[model samples]
Target: MTQVNRPQPPVRIQSSRVAESIAADLRQRILRGTYPEGPLPKQDDLILEYGVSGPSLREALRILEAEGLITVRRGKVGGAYIHPPNWSSAAYALGLAMQGQSVRVHDLAMAIRELEPRCAESCAEREDRLETVVPALEKNIEASEDALGDGAHFTEVSRTFHDVFVDLAANQTLRLVVRSLVAVWTIQEQAWADAMEGEGRYPDIEQQKAVLKAHRAITRLVARGDRNKVGKIATEHLAATQPRVLQFCGDRTIDASSATAMRGFRGLK
Candidate 1:
């Protein structure tokens, strides 16, 4: 038999392991709301707390900062501050990967099609749907009406309605993923708006009215806790609304302008 050798993955250095361990410990404390002790502790204090070298402690803090869990400041007065997790960051990161993949406007539509309607189902399934979900969605509808014919205002409000619709689903993980999807789609919406450039900005009045009507009906279904009905209605509504925006996409690839808008989505989300 001929001798053969198998390649193995590179070993993890001990220093990297120590830094990761410290980062994990700090992340757990932050999530559990047990750290910071009023003001973010000094580096010296953290070094003692983790019993790690200064370099290892600094590396761990850098890791947390990259994960969007903490913000580090540089000054006599500056200390690390805990930042709540942001889906915008996740969405913005996903957008970069999407740009590389030549993702299409239809891809965005499919994502929203699967996600936002399930959110409606979640609202319907919730025990407190009447007291919580119904009122918020009603508010969204009312505001949408107020913004009618005002392209910019209506666009923002409608986005909020979609965001809250998913948010009301009561699953944090689902809310995070869907919220990021919503953020990504907003890039496509802006691309269409820019394509409109000097042409008619807002959709036809009847089209806008139809949107508001569908939202109202979905909210009603949610109030009644009709899960199947809410899900079906929402899926149909988003599917119907998508083609109107697909008209503006360029070659199934995010154009330079739209890609720029996508990169800036963190601020919007």
Candidate 2:
């Protein structure tokens, strides 16, 4: 006697799975500049293009929105807006993860102390330092000098110096990683500056001058292409300056729900 095979049932894909597949395709398109002009094509258009139901397409948009890839607005003028991910998004995610793990502010400071100097060293190693790196840093130093007496303003300018330093580094991966850490640290430091100013304990002008001196020294080292000295100087400068903020933070963990960080995210392009 011979046995016969039964007919097989059609495989039905879940809406959620369909949504994920739709999301992946749209996500790549958004990231690759497919919709560079504006918010994604109208939802109706996307639904048509993907040949999926409205619910499935909407679910796909939801996934991208949650990942910071796009923003969906609801109104007569509403549509899903594309927001390509950048360093700030990376920083916000990093901040959330650190907050989830209860990572301390001092721990973040320590990580920056070790990592950022390498960025400075890399800046010194850049072949186009004169055209690309030095001018930006020197201009930032001038802003720092002008901001010397205003503690809060000075802190902001000084932080920009480090931001520019990291941005100028030749290593793209290190630049992004360090810059994310710096962005997170900037929120804390700026908050500390505000609090200290309120309490009349913000670093005095003399202390601000000292910071300027260190920044100038580091700039000179980079201009001279002295990678060895620039890294060492950067390390020393961070060591001296971080304590002013860290002392206020104590054992407090970074706040992922920080309104400042969120506000920064909102302004990202």
Candidate 3:
């Protein structure tokens, strides 16, 4: 009996692997602000720079595009425009994940109930509350007040107050996380408002005024750096408001693909 050994052939690199490598490099550059001023180097230029085949380069760009990092345009004006990651993108991603899990409106509302109060507390703990948080919140409160009597409009304005309040939190991580949840919740709640308004069942003017008053009181507490009081008030405010939206939502799952939800992102930044 004779034993034979076969020589191993050279392994070919997969286009996906090459694309991933290129995507990794470009992703870091995008995050690092390497191409801050304009679209990324042209495809030809990137191809030359990376010394890869056109398909590999294109695949790499696709990868970045899918990650919400680059926007690939077409025709003469076509180039891969850089979009460094931000809160809205994070929120969209989070929404997708929640949607995939069939996360319900009430689940999101409950999670918001737990997380958003912490954001308010963080805002109150900021040393420059007067210069930063208070004014923004007060401005939003004024807008909310002005929109009173218009149910849908008032809902929109009041939601902005929460968005602004969360954005003012000093912790970047907490700000982003809470803001993402709020963004999702805002879409859901605003949809509820629009529907209820259409049905002539949206909250009354007095209820809207109560919401504005709560916002104003939260702002004052944030101004005084009353962290505990502001957090408590925020918790109470959310408790009072979320149920209406939740009742409309019932057991409905979070909708990441709703046309209304997609439109909502345009106003996020």
Candidate 4:
């Protein structure tokens, strides 16, 4: 795969919107061990803390839930409880929202170009830390190699490899954005993988190898603190892989700008 180079400043102009702020505060608290895996702070406590109403507090909790931070229970035992959030549900919501969106391979390429440099830059900053992310990347690479003959296994490992970037980026907002996009891409890619499975080419070991190689190279770049090189490699690697993905899937039918349609359909956003 030909590596393409794109560079971005480390800073991103993230929104300080109300919900985002509430979400950020709560995420910080959770990360700092304020919540842990116990019952969440009572709604009244949260309402008092934030000077918000029951509805607003509930909305904040919803964001937490969407991010996989808390489990809201009903019945006598039910209230919000702190737990690690999984990205899968959010990813699926993104997948459903993108289900009918009009997307071309090039549109996918364009979106990636916009987002990846930021991820690369962030990952590069944390690359040397190696406390959480780099090991996870390597682990997924190893897992992929072992799972090459299994279609279901390969799909999962591939997703994990990409997800490592989201974690490394370390920006909650960007993590959410890329995760949602990955969910949609996964759906499209899965379709292709399924088709390939039918032709006795179910396991594309070579494709996995290419993707793994790209990841390993990027990891090395990040470890070296070469932000420019990392960003370039990320863009090039992502863009070059489009044809490989498209070979297994078709263009998306719905554009993300019409995401409101998903809300109407689900009665939730």
Worst 10 residues of 1 by lDDT: 250-259
RMSD over all Cα atoms, model 1:
5.6
1-269 per-residue lDDT for model 2 (tens digits): 89898877543457889999999998888888887847889999988888889999999999998997988999998999887878888888998999999999999999999999999999898888989888998899888888888868788788899999888888899989999999888888888998998898998899998988898899899989999999999999999999888889948999767687677545432
Q: Write the per-residue lDDT of candidate 4 for residues 64-117, one digit (tens) a residue.
A: 887667878888877898875456556555555544554564466567567866
Clashing pairs in 1: none
Q: Residue-wise lDDT of candidate 3 within 162-217, one digit each (tens)?
A: 88878887788999899999999998888999999999999899888888888888
**Clash pairs (backbone) in predicted model 3:** none
Error of 3 at 68 (Å): 1.8
Tens-place lDDT per residue, model 1, 114-134, is: 888888898899998888888
Task: Quantify all predictions' global Cα lDDT against the true fold.
Answer: 0.78, 0.87, 0.88, 0.68
Q: TM-scores of the models, in the given order?
A: 0.80, 0.92, 0.93, 0.59
* Candidate 2 to native Cα RMSD, angstroms: 3.2
lDDT of 1: 0.78
Model 1: number of backbone collisions: 0
Which model, 1 or 2, shows the larger TM-score? 2
What's model 3's lDDT at 76? 87
Answer with 1 or 4, whichever has the higher lDDT. Answer: 1
Model 2 local distance difference test score: 0.87
TM-score: model 2 vs. ground truth: 0.92
